[model samples]
Target: MNIEFKKNKLSIALSIALLTNLSLMAEEKSPKELDSVTVIGNENSDYKSKEKVKLNRTKMDIEDTAKSIQSFNENFIEDSQLQNIENIITMSSNTVYNGDNHGRTNDISMRGFSGVPILIDGLKVTNKMAHPEVYNFESIEIQKGPDSLQYGESSPGGIVNLVKKKPTKETLGKIELEVSDNSSYTPKLDVAGSLNKEESLYFRLVSVLKYDEGWTNSNTETNKVFIAPSLSYDVNDNHTLTFMAEYTDETTPSSFGTYVNSKGNLVAPIKNTISNPDEEFEKTQKIIGFDLDSTFDTWNSNFRYRYIDYEGDNGNVHMPQSYNEATNIVSRAFASQKQEFEEHALQYTLNKEIDILEFKNKISLGADYNKAYSKLDMFYDPSTPYLINLSHPSYEHLTSASEHSGVMDMSSDKTYVESWGTFLQDSIYLTNNLIFNAGVRYSESKPKNGQRSDALTPSFGLVYHFSDQTSIYTNYSESFTPNSQEDTSGNILDPEEGKGYEIGIKQKLFDDNLNLTAAIFKIEKENIAELDPDDPTLSKYKASGKQESRGFELDINGNITPNWSIVASYGYTDTKNKDNNNLDLKNIPEHTANIFTSYYLTSFGLPNTYIGGGAKYLGSRYADENNKIKFDSEIIYNATVGYKKGRWRANLSVQNLTDEEYVDGALSSNARGTRVYVGTPRTLLATISYSF
Candidate 1:
């Protein structure tokens, strides 16, 4: 792996040298057709695009929003073959896959915090533990920092929004088949067109089937089936309604991953080997939603409602003690549980534009309400023996881990949690080049057996444009989440609170074909609940906890020349637990970066041919809270070559071309122990598609 990395590094240097000499060649190409070279999408140029409504619940350009945001469109998704959220984060700056990747949740972490929620079409549809397929969505949007004013009660890191594909009046669709080197097969179908002759109604249907036979020792197999159907109706010139439904069923192996030996390497007898290949889990998930949009002379409004349900049963194997180097063995135990979850949510927004004494103003008001319930039952027996050997394993011994004596051994009991929030924001243009923004939200949460808590959060921002292509901005925001913890008397503790501040400058050049943004930010939190220092078994709570984080991020996107397109970013973050110097957050790389670029080869008599590659670098990160064990830094390189002509396209992509061994996820210490999931090796994916 080390030799491969060195070779790739040399290649990267040579590629840069070649790019530096392409200026003369770029100047000779026809500029007229440059507009047809789409990178993100067809809506706007590579440097500047349409306003994002998720920022302030109103249409506002990126320069006027005074916050950090990143977006990936259809073109990028297809070119990169980003099948899941984990794949997206690998190329995303300052982001880490915090989740264990247990085939359940797409848990992401940024700026040292974890479990940021994922929203679908502006509505919170599922909890943090669900990982939905991305093929059904048209684009992905990420809003960094505290966004509680727009989306309520989330980690200060940020939020992700998946924009679903809507029904189009024009008849258009595509069918695609994909195959990978990992013994995976996938077939997909998508079609959208007018449902009525008048073109007032439209519908779209998408379905996909996949089967993946994973690595050898990992003992993991995943099979999935997904279907989504949607319909849209145009009631009048100013009103529209859309309905959408999705269903998914999957079966996968359940395990916490492999133990990291004292040498800091994953303990695998050989690649693809699994210590517990027989343990498995099955799950089913469903979602139904609708949206209503209306535009009036004075204002525009939108309403969304969704319901989600999930059921699954999983068997887990836990290794408590560290692996003995001499014996090459680790002691482990097994358990099984059945769980269910259901949630319903509704959201509404109203936007108005008005002129106040020569100042143009945009105001938005919104509300969100949601209720969730979950239940779990576990099978256990004191008499059952549970143990396994790493070098030598057997399913017969593992069966003893799920023993039950006629009745369920334990349960989490039935629990219900409800939350709601209301917010109002105003963006006032004090002058043609100056803008001021202010917003506030009132949020509350109620537990089935604890006291309800509510609070008010606020935010403010200012932007000054120097010209059509340059601007400077600053902002401050606050966030809060009610704690579910209770003392001996059964009273809820205070809610966690966060305050953040940011300042940045943005610029565009070469007719808005190149975009650059740089920002520095700081966040502080209070009222963080934690366990009593004196007691480890009999737990006690304290609200007097503190944490602080500071960081700087730089992002560049769009085209450098008529035929050259690029997306790149760099991030530096420092985080600390103020009250406890011994603890640090896990899986957060202090320095991370990504850069990918593609150039159309119109000069070599191959007008539709293109080749591109990029590198991702991650700094060393700790696996345990105490920072005793650390994973070394790594750099992975990838390349792609493809051709597009008329309506047909074919591409071959190689990820981790160097076959670098790395760790992408680490489970923090608990009763079980610390274990890490090995990163994927060099893999190849080939895709072909035709669109009408």
Candidate 2:
């Protein structure tokens, strides 16, 4: 097979290419063809376990994909101890985290912008940055760089996807109960069983409950619930069908602690650690989705339906102002905010493998329909309008490290939005070792009080493999986002749009035990819809929407040896306004790196023991676009010691082990003054777990 992809191709040529290749698009299996069919048959022979078997895909199998993709399994998550989607940034080399926002708020930078899409089990999830629950996932796949053909009107940064666990013929399950030093308790139960009586049917179920008092001296508790059920049936020895559904709900408070000083240094917020169980801020989210599939001797088909409801509210709790000592001020302020977002999507796919031109080839065709609706209500009305004279404890919003409370607007904040899109894509394996992929999309978005636009975006990509251990790939993507809410004075801004290109190479070694990847990427943003400075023309400004970002990356993750595993990354990024030439992208550091590793002490002495440590480093960054000032970069270190014997385990971990003071994030909106938040300092956590 020889796969050569031209940049521009008429629809007629692609149709003809597919119509003329019967053996490669149909499911009819012949003796000689059975040896090379790439669907779900012979490939199953690669490993003793399904986890390993799933990683055997070569470059030719995915070269035609519409986006740049990377896949990881349970071992990857377990080895990294990823908490949720929020922690995924630490797991992927191409990702950078802007703030902890205490999980209440999240800002991401890929290429150079935010607002990328998320997917579950291959279906679009939500574009909002809120982290989704991760209790029932088997693996995760990231499709980045370019994606206009498969998903409509998306940000050029890329896509994040989570693959659900399916029912298998084997009965497997785990029940775990863990307690941490922060007064956090989590109990989880997961079970998968085969319907032996049906021979071809299997089922799986999972549930979890978590509560934490938190690292803050203020008493707080967080909880989550997740349930996923799946059923898979073998229609025959060569075909199988599966059905699955997932649901999750959770809430966490917004601990808006700030940091800042007049001399441009960091400061801690004055807080009340007392127990006020009734005063706090929070967020709640829920998601539901299902998928269907059919397979034949040579081809496989699938249908997916996904629906999600995400809503959150942040109010009440008194948040601190900037932590700057020089600009120290305690003001009476209040904010009441609420958001509601909904998504529904449907998709269909067809894939097959065949021999042609003296070579074996693979093909994929798919179409998708997506609809999204959202609305947010926001209001900020301060009680003590001006910073109270801190020297005077009786002044408004000014008290000791404990006594301070003010009124926040409770009735004036409310807003809403709605949007939708459709997309299609195709992948053709022109040769046994090379792949080509292309896609296109159209979308229409309408907000309650803003302009609406219908957009079309196209994408392309290519992948070349040297062997099962290494591959090289490149891709292009585009996206659009609208800014709806507005201040008084009958004023509004335009929407934001992003575009970018990425190229990289990946290597897998040690019998699939170690993986390494490196890539260079560039992303740009235009029509940013910012405020006019020169003319203050409200709606007209030349440099308002101009911005660009460029960077290079190196990342590696996997077992150094059977008992030693690690994940590490280093990135250099630079973002600026193309028009103004004097502004810097806030929160995006010029340098970032993280290294985490673990080793089983049992390899030398004990059979069920481990020791681990890691560190995360963020370089100095701007808190505003002007780049007039900077926040010192800081490094956070962690260490852990644990042992597992039979069905029981225990461990002690120290976070910020060196007590290295660090700021998780910083920002300045609608003001000349900057604001920042220092992440936790030195803290210790201990955990004990058991399974029956």
| TM-score on alpha carbons, each prediction | 0.88, 0.78
**Global lDDT scores for all candidate models:** 0.73, 0.58
Q: What does each candidate score in C-alpha RMSD?
A: 9.2, 13.6
Q: Give the TM-score of candidate 2.
A: 0.78
lDDT of 1 by residue, 97-116 (tens): 75555556777877667767
Q: Could you tell me the lDDT of residue 370 within candidate 2?
A: 62
Q: 376, model 1: CA deviation in Å? A: 1.1
